[model samples]
Target: MELIQKVLDQPVAVSQPASLRPYNSKLKVHDQILCGKIMHSNFSKLAYSIMQSVGYVHDIRAVLFEYMLL
Candidate 1:
């Protein structure tokens, strides 16, 4: 509960386009898309682990929906 509350209290971190740097300065469009997919997958796994640890695995959808309402 404390961990969840702490996460909820923190403001969202939004990154600007200028702040993003590709792994390879010469990265192609395909590479950029691949990088984005990998990052999304990693974040999803991390979020699932956190919810599982907090015993909210079963209520994940409901929790996210309520949070979005806020």
Candidate 2:
């Protein structure tokens, strides 16, 4: 069987908290918004940058033969 990526790497500091483990479970967080934080996670920041930069430059249509392209 194929293996999937682990969500978190080994914690770098001995003082890492238990709450950090909960941050690795992503299926629980899809499509939800984050509010009122001093800073966001790096992954979340990259995602927002991608969405803002390349989000709506393509169009989709349906016909006898339908397809999606970018």
Candidate 3:
């Protein structure tokens, strides 16, 4: 993975593909979309884990709320 700065301020690290083809989108450094999607998915999992650790509400409700926030 190659770490690069996005828009001069935010630093977003992204995966660097093994090879680049003419039509392949992996070479495009400007697109932070793949990174963003992975981040969101990971964040949701973390939230659910935190909720489960606290364990105030029922297990089902905690999971529902965690997904609903996403």
Q: Judging by lDDT against the true structure, name the best candidate.
A: 1
lDDT score for candidate 3 against the true structure: 0.36
Candidate 2 TM-score versus the reference:
0.26
Candidate 3 structure, TM-score to reference: 0.26
Runs of candidate 3 with Cα error greater than 4 angstroms are 1-40, 57-70
Query: Local distance difference test, per candidate?
Result: 0.42, 0.26, 0.36
Q: What lDDT tens digits, residue by residue, belong to model 2 across residues 1-70? A: 1111221221112123334434433311321221103234544333333333454211211110122112
lDDT digits (tens) for residues 1-70 of candidate 1:
7765654444332122422644233332222322344244444444545654567644563444355349
Cα error, residue 70 of model 2, in Å, equals 28
What is the per-residue lDDT of model 3 for residues 1-70, given as tens digits with 9 covering 90 to 100? 1211222233333234424423234323212232344344543344334443455323443345445449
Off by over 4 Å in 2: 1-39, 56-70
> Of models 1 and 3, which has the larger lDDT?
1
User: What CA RMSD would candidate 1 show?
Assistant: 12.8
For candidate 1, the clash count comes to 0
Cα TM-score per model? 0.31, 0.26, 0.26
**Clash tally, candidates in order:** 0, 0, 0
In Å, residue 68's CA in model 3 sits off its true spot by 3.8
